[model samples]
Target: MSRARSHRWLRRPNGDTTPRFAYGADYNPDQWPREVWHEDIRLMREAGVNVVSLAIFSWARIQPTEDTWDFGWLDEIMDLLHEGGIGVDLATATASPPPWLTTAHPEILPVTASGETVWPGARQHWRPTSPVFREHALRLVTTMAERYAGHPALVAWHISNELGCHNIYDYSDDAARAFRDWLRARYGDLDALNSAWGTAFWSQRYSDFEQVLPPRLAASHPNPTQQLDFKRFSSDALKQYLVAEREVLTRITPDVPVTTNFMVMGETKGMNYADWAAEVDFVSNDHYVLPGPQSLDELSFSANLTGNIAGGRPWFLMEHSTSAVNWQPINRAKLRGELARDSLLHVAHGADAVCFFQWRQSAAGAEKYHSAMVPHAGADSAVFRAVSALGATLRDLAPAAGAPRRPARAALLFDWESWWASEQDSHPTSRLRYRQEALDWYSAFLALGVRADIVPRGAALEGYDLVVAPVLHVLPAELAKELTAYVEGGGHLVTTYFSGIVDENDHAWLGGYPGPLRDLLGIRIEEFAPLLDDETVTLDNGATGTLWTDEITLTAPDVEVLATYTSGAQAGRPAITRRPAGPGSAAYVSTRLGAQGLTPVLARLLAAAGIGSELPEEARGHVELAVRGDGDTEFWFLVNRTDEPVRLPGVTGDVLSGPTGGGTADDPLVLHPRGVTVLRRPAGR
Candidate 1:
């Protein structure tokens, strides 16, 4: 089968495709009375909502007792939605086990690192590795799948609601047992496992797989490799549950696409979605705007990351905020026009659907004040009007659905294993952040008006001219060899300090500062000089650097010094080095350069690699431009993140939304503060 058609769950056997942008929210009919549900569907139709996720948190209502099943209420709801011309992303209601299930099977409750039980006052109380929890969840999923196999209202089958949101890391005895079994299966023997973890240090060597345990409380730091393996196991444990539920769904209804919403935003970092992406028939994600200086930038980064996870195939925006979210410490409501702007931003980055946490506001719950399509106020409110307008705009963008992102010229190496291992305690500097360093380099590309794709560490090096690996603390041997071969094969390469030093097991390379990559960049680092909070370093190239600095030396005559420290004890040493590797080259940045300092270096690298920004000259400094192409058609997504009105003098195309585009090639493109425009232009326009 073709890759596109292999997704039989998405493209139904009847050949009905999803709308351009699936617009709706988590529809909890059980939260409201029967009278309110009719009005809810009416309002949904008015707002152009074609799909509503149903039965997400309805396990208790669906199956009240252990033996009894009550599909009458769900039957009415599904029939009502079917009559109202609405499609359903039918959830299996396996997110939170009901109170009875958890009460009867107390073994299912998760345990913390300190051996404290996670009580069931809230949701997501069950541990993923608990067999009792798995049994109950499987039964419920089977019942739902069998009951709703051929329901006309069913469009897509949502397996569970936000898997691993609260139950990602369980430190119970059950988890320890699972961890040992996982290790045994991975290494096949205790000898290989001991070698991988380098257990000879501190006399931590294990003679048997049963002796292996999850990294728990320790005097100093727990084994770093043990911690890394636990992180991998935790993600895989949750994925096992997802796979179990998916098996039930697919066994009953073979044509329905099965997926679980991933909470892939903010500081939540327990589960690895790249590994979990293969288990789902289609990918869906939940994201929220974080409160910080770089919130919007973080939003774009996450949306782009999710898009990349889908392999640039269109995915679903499972949840987002409509106004003020209730969970933040100081909840700030979004300003005017923020709703549509946020939704369109996701659409620009390959989201085929836009949805919110809920359809109507909850009056009695932990998230009562959380923003929704219908706020606490009546339907005549400003939030409602904006939601309706966004729905209409999504309908207008129907023609541009399923367009893949244009090939990126530059790639940023993002690895979850590295992210997990790099930030573990006892490192030279605890503040040597993995994601922030990559984001800092990413922001430089954004500032220069370029689109760079974040790719997996093991992804192919083809089609990319330049690749940047920032703060890659855990560098496996194979990847080091591949990157060196890439440079020798005429591909540009750049790696920063704190990288290429450790192997996959978190063991040092034993040679010099940079273990395997020392010869590739023709530089050897003697030691890392991590700066204090009050200290700074001045580079001779007229830039200030802080956080961390590496004392480096050029090892070969072919290497050239790009920058040297002007101040500090290691003054006059090479702070940056580049080596000519045949037709291409590799550069090493020995310190953390702030946004201003990295621009010129990146510009030089990109120029040497023959990659330039595609943004028009007039729109370079003012607008955020991202392009996606489908055959002869191209979509130009222009977002004005600043306060000034952006003017594109020589650009014109069919304006899909907002005020940045209109008319033919001679017309000037204009955008106001926070304004977004998606212009459709054919090839060679």
Candidate 2:
């Protein structure tokens, strides 16, 4: 039998001419007085919020006791929303369980790797493997699905809130047992498991399945391999939870899409989005851009990654603060035009819909200060006006903006397992950070106005002309094979410090520093020394910089040095080098460099690979370019994300701009800040 479709994802149902645009914010009428429901609906309609995500944290009200469920309030709320012509993205109400449920079934609560049982207060506090939690949670979802499966306003089913809470994996006895079962099913034999884990080194062999325990803070070894295994296990455990919940929801509403919101690039949680993609219908993520120009690169990189996760499928901007977030160390409102700019950028990249974390600001709670469409001051506030303006724009531009677009010829490999393993290592340089390093490379590209895709290391490497893998610590054997093949097949590959150290199981590769990639990279690492103090590295090729000191030897005869360490004993040695594999070339950097030091080298490589940084020579300066292609048409978006007024380029006339004109190749067009222009070209150039 074919698998059931996830109901919380986007689906082009009935081939409707009016494309489905989920222009809505999260709603929690449970907290508001009953008298206010009508006003809220009216306000939502005014703001063009056609959909509202409801019941995200309503488990407490729905199941006051294990045997009793109260649906009277929910029925009224659903009816009200339906009457208002708003679609419903119904949440499973499993984000947080009620205090009574936890008190009655304590086993359902999650235990951290540190042995602390995560209590009932926070969201994502449930244990995935717990029978009680699964039984109770499934019942809730099943009942809701069955009741609302054919509801006119129901558009999708949100399975649960963010999968892993503070951290990934629960080390409860139940979780441990479930993990062992998962491993047994995956490897099929104890010998294979032992070999994969390299159990002989630390005498950590498991005599029986019962001896296995979930990787925990107490039992975790400093060994990179063990730590990496723990990371993988944690990711799998969390994925299993999502799959279980998805299975239940799909059974009830197979026609609708299903999804869960992801926190972008969070490392401590151990959720690898790529691993979760196959199970989800499409991906949705929360974009919480830090409040400053400094965070722009991070925000763009995250947006790029989210786009790639859905395989270029349009994703929902599930939750962003409409004004300011309450939880950050210093919460501040987004400057007047900043929020709109950020949201537009998401669309410029790959987002199909934009929504805020909340519809109304909370009056009492930890999130009371969190921004919302309507603040505590009510519907007449300035924040509400801003929201209303955005809604109006979305409604007007929905037809044009909702269509998809693909980016240009850049690709960055994001390996969550490698990130987890690299950090788990006890001996690697303490300065090494997985996400930060990846972000650094990504930022370099974005700063130069180069559009890139953030792909998993295992994604198909053929389409990309430039593949950059920075700090790829744990190289999955399959990915290693693909990388080698890609480089040998004439693609340019760039990798940096502390890469290829571990295998899939997170065990150190015994052969050399870059164990699996040593042959592919044509280098041998003789010794790795930590740079305890500040130092500089100068390349023989005129590039000079400071880097954590490490001495490496070139094993490949064809390799050529690019940069050398300046101060340490490894000074004048190759800090960076390139070698030809087959049809293409491979570049390796032995140490990390700041953005200034890295960007020039990256530009050189990109240029050498024949990738164009500048847009068509005829294009104007102020017009930022983004391109996405379907079968026969290439959609190009020219957006002015900057604050000042600017001119449009070439010929573009859609609803965004009032009229169309094909100017001479030399003529330039001007556009105001926050203006967007989309142009289309037929396929076959």
Q: Which candidate is the best by lDDT?
A: 1
Candidate 1 lDDT at 550 equals 88
Q: Report the C-alpha displacement of residue 230, candidate 1, in angstroms.
A: 0.6
Query: Residue by residue across 231-302, what tens digits does model 1's lDDT show?
Result: 999999988888888888878998788778887777677888877787887788999998876677778778
Most TM-score-accurate candidate: 1
Q: Rate the local accuracy (lDDT) of all candidates.
A: 0.84, 0.74
Q: Write the per-residue lDDT of candidate 2 for residues 322-426, one digit (tens) a residue.
A: 778887789988777666666766776677778898998889888999988998878888788888877766665555554555755779999887777666636
TM-score of each: 0.96, 0.92
**Stretch of 10 with least lDDT, candidate 1:** 1-10
Give me the runs in candidate 2 sitting further than 4 Å from their true place.
1-15, 219-223, 266-269, 291-294, 533-549, 614-624, 639-667, 671-685
For model 1, give the RMSD to the true fold: 2.2
